[model samples]
Target: MSESLLAALLALLVVPALLAIHAGDLLLATLTLGGYGFAMALTWAALGAVDVAFTEAVVGAGATTVLMLAALLRTTRRRSPLPGRLRWAALLVVGTVGLALGAVTAALPPWGDPDTPAAVHVSPRYLTSAVAETATPNVVTAVLADYRSYDTLIETVVIVTAGLGCWLLLGPRSR
Candidate 1:
């Protein structure tokens, strides 16, 4: 993707994020956040991470939005306002974290650079020997299911736990 297109996508991502943050209505915030997720998916796609983009679109923009809207159905539309001091404190913390992250990002190699540590260290082994090592034809599948089995299992467990928690919290309550 061209630099201008990527920059535009990044800019688009920020608008919905800011809108979601500043939105008083929970519904509006939820919708804005969905837009932010979609924009994030587009950004990921532009960066040549199509799998990540699909996951973001499905889980971030789709499932998350549906879940939030369902939760909203059981709650008030408007959120309780935060006190001035607390809001400022939250903003300060967010700004500090954002700046720190920006600094770290600026220090990193360019996206998809072939000489990055990850690409140089482990990726070549995975790309060349994944099929023989794991008996999986697809490198991504082999990596996720075989090489990174524990990580993938933990991520699955976390997702399942989150789903259960959401269900228990949002499901019909008995008297």
Candidate 2:
């Protein structure tokens, strides 16, 4: 079979399996959520983002979902009724906004296209001058870890702060 045909068949099989995975049981629901995270990691890997895939696999499939399930285990097991009119209206508005944002994204430049202005402008200089300036073979690594180090450092600090906040909030509160 052709590669495209195999991929299409795999997607056809996977879509319904994913959609059918709703579970009233919290443990089963958590497993389903982790499965979804693993799927997302697979998608990131397919897109050539190994770093993102690794992070997603670790955080999403491993830590976050486990934490969620643990919290759920500590709470009540019964399912609650769906929210009322105000919440439905808010959800509708949010969905509409999300659809509009997705439409805008669909019109954006295709990734990694050399003809796109973004690819042309930022890429050429990095490719041409990175080795000379940094003595690094990987231009992307050099740019991310060196030239834009401040931005990366700030993002790391933000993540650490968020983790600390979560730990503090979830920790025991003494009277």
Q: For each candidate, C-alpha RMSD in Å?
A: 2.7, 4.2
List model 2 lDDT by residue over 86-116, tens digit each: 7789889989999999999998887556698
Could you tell me how far off, in angstroms, the CA of residue 127 lies in candidate 1 after the best superposition?
A: 1.4
Q: Tell me the number of clashing residue pairs for each predicted model.
A: 0, 0
TM-score of every model?
A: 0.81, 0.70
lDDT (tens digit, per residue) of candidate 1 on 9-112: 88778789999988999999999999999989989999888878999999889999998898799877788887899989988999999999999999899976
Q: Give the poorly placed runs of model 2, Cα more than 4 Å off.
A: 1-22, 83-91, 102-106, 110-112, 172-175
Q: Please give the lDDT score for candidate 2.
A: 0.76
Model 2: weakest 10-residue lDDT segment is: 13-22
Q: Which portions of model 1 show Cα errors greater than 4 Å?
A: 134-137, 163-175
Q: What is the C-alpha local distance difference test score of each model?
A: 0.89, 0.76
Give the per-residue Cα lDDT of candidate 2 at 72: 81
User: What lDDT would candidate 1 get against the real structure?
Assistant: 0.89
At residue 165, candidate 1 shows an lDDT of: 84
Give the 10-residue window scoring lowest on summed lDDT in candidate 1.
166-175
